[model samples]
Target: MKRTVRNLLALTLVLAAGAAAKADEVLLQSAKSGLYVTVVNGTLAASAQDARQAVKLDTVRLEGNKIAFRDVRSGTYVRAGVGQGTMLATGSPHIRSWETFELDRTGRGEVALRSSQNGLYVRAGVGRGSHLAAVSERARDWETFRLVDVRNAGGHQDRPRPGQGNGNGNHNAGQGPDLSSLIGNYRITHVTADNGFLVPLGRELAGRARMSIEGRGNLSATAGCNSISARIAVENGRFQTRSQPMSTKMGCVIRGQSLVENRISQILTEARTVQRDGRIVTLRARNGAELLKLRRM
Candidate 1:
């Protein structure tokens, strides 16, 4: 009964549009090892275009290990071994692999690796040319992936790879630093141009602020300007903002305006990767260019 109610509530939240109940819509992104991997949000509410047409996507869900969106659309991409044939069987190595779906429309859907061993599927969109983007091997821990935000960068039909690397995705459950050491709210005082980040909010978002972090991959904050909300998706001891739903009132002027804008953008663009030294959690960017100081807010 409880599970049915929960499923109903989840669907209801996606259907209703008002003040958000919580950060319920999760967009699971697949990290490309050397390049950015694009994710197809879901089937468009409107018409389907050509091999390279823009599809207006609505909600997104992150298809990662440990977390699964049961109520979401059934097409989230997962990892699988490229076989000589097109069908995947039960209890295969690819069955245990997990990877995000690419942008393609040729029935490359996201499904459970726990059930199938078929290679990853991508829905077509607007990708030109033939790029051999394959997930022959499973994703490992701390393995970096980038989102290609370039113009007309996403959309392509993927082919199968028969013989690939040994399929053992990176595992970090029992390795690395402790989770508690990095849990706290920090202030993003500055940023570096080498940070390779696009400001999520604004450059004017600056000033006295607090960003509270929890061990369960959750983050909440006050922009020193307004109440800011965002979900923290942590991987490999690093965090990036997901669905940064904010309640900031646009009522600032002059320097106050700058404070609101700067702080909000900084917090969003500020991808936090903390280095722990006892009780002090020194949060830094991925490139070590910009660093932040978080306390128990």
Candidate 2:
């Protein structure tokens, strides 16, 4: 009964507007890594895949395009200091003094945050575990971040308190890994069916199968004779095909092409969980069953 009620509530949240009406806990995910903006000690950074206290800042208020955020746990406002590339939280009484940021929409689901005081935009830094800094004049790819709807992310993940070891032994968890690193080309190694059976592609579809996920959520793939393309949403290490992928209408010439295309389409549409271990990425179903495995090329 409890599980059913929880599921119903989750469904209702999804059916409602993407962001909460108040926009209090909305997630600001870096367009480059998909990691959300967070606070480390006192410095502002983008280093969290899951919603946590460090990443859960409140939008205290918004006046026109100027917005201000406050750390929910610490109650300190995110302020930009002079010559300070990194932002910080402060308890100073002047909340609007240096906490104002200008929001500019770059594209669908993306925005560039410019400091109202410094006139510089926020950059999500390059490579893994990069600290965020407000030092750019242009809204480049690293400067733009997507506003992820926190309600859709099953609430925030609990973060370790200050002075407490990051719960897990993985010290790098606090520093967000580049989940978008999966953007490069990958070669399909094997396909795991819904029934938990692993089917090797072998020669007919082994080396020929290729997939590339663009930064804009566009997916392009080739499996033997079929060419497939689709728009997919990769969020919080999971992906769902937004639309039915388009493919070449030509009939399959190879013996395994038809089966491969069907399987690939199914996997792409139903994949829910994504696990990346170094160069290997595994896409799994909602039931925790592996659906497809790929290796970075």
What local distance difference test score does each model get? 0.34, 0.63
Score candidate 1 by TM-score against the native.
0.31
Best by TM-score: 2
lDDT of 2 by residue, 182-290 (tens): 6888998888543334467888578788888888878887776878899877666666788898888778777777677778888888766566767776675443335
- The true-versus-predicted C-alpha distance at residue 42 of model 1, in Å, is 38
- Candidate 2 clashing pairs, residues 3+ apart or interchain: 51-157
- Which 10 consecutive positions of candidate 1 have the poorest summed lDDT? 164-173
Compose the digit string of candidate 1's lDDT tens values, residues 8-101: 7545434431232323333222332222222111111111111122211122232322222221222222332223212211111111222223
Supply every candidate's count of residue pairs whose N, Cα or C atoms clash at under 3 angstroms: 36, 1
Deviation from native of the Cα of residue 207 in model 2, angstroms? 56
Candidate 2 versus the native: TM-score? 0.43
